[model samples]
Target: MFKKVPILIFFFLIFFVSFEDLYSKDEYFLTLRNEKVNLRQGPSFDYPVKILYKKKFLPVLIQDSSDNFRKIRDHENNSGWVHISQLSKKKAAIVIEEELILFGKSTIFSNPVALLKQGRLVKINKCKIEWCKVKTGKYKGWVSKNGLWGLL
Candidate 1:
């Protein structure tokens, strides 16, 4: 019986490592599931004025639970809840290069931003909108919607 002690310990260790994967936060890659999503100010359709999150867009901030609402923070640090049905899970390319630009500051408007690195993730903010916003290095800002991705 003593000879089996080490084997049992090895199996126990393996189980412990894999256990974390079960409880880890569920992550989903955004996909353009809907034709359009409105970025409302409140959780329900009754909310007040706020910018619109148009169609076929990918947002940097992702949500998986259909809680009917999502708490979000704007670049100005404003916080509020919005309707989850008004959003989609579409993924896009984000520039990860060390050097990048703030879309508003650039003039080209077409290909104003460049020097993007590989493997960076960007949620197309709004394709129809004039400016597109992206999330990189934990920071969110606007980019031209026509360039590559749309506003989510």
Candidate 2:
């Protein structure tokens, strides 16, 4: 049993470290997995439902976590808790500024591909510096990162 003691201790340490990394309060963004998700006032099912979000792919900031629940804040600054299963790691963002120009290239001098209105949800391809490559419906282009909500 003496030799088994160290092995068990090593496994425990690994599990603890993995758990912490998985749920760390690093302020990352996650999108809604389902078309409808309930935002609770607290971290459990016993808590009241504060909001019923019907929009899928809506990005929310993961502020904190409790058990299987995540504390999130939406673009409107509404904060609440949601179950982890309702969240997705898929990169997405909502246009926060009205009439955002989607440029063919990352620069403003590039040709305007399309105009995106506020509340438009776009799948984030990638982001560099002050611009992000996004796709919304049939259009895909770069937009100013300042006009979006969901990036660090």
Q: Which candidate comes out best when scored by lDDT?
A: 2
Error of 1 at 86 (Å): 3.1
Scanning candidate 2 in windows of ten residues, the lowest lDDT window is 19-28
lDDT of candidate 2 vs native?
A: 0.96
The residue-by-residue lDDT of candidate 1 on 84-110, one tens digit each, is 655555556444344455454324454
lDDT of 2 by residue, 6-92 (tens): 999999999999999876847899999999999999999999999999999899999998999999999999999999999999999
Q: After superposition, how far is residue 49 of candidate 2 from its true place, in Å?
A: 1.0
Clashes of each: 13, 0
- Give candidate 2 regions above 4 Å deviation: 1-25
Which lDDT value does model 2 have at 124?
Answer: 99
- Each model's Cα RMSD: 11.0, 4.8
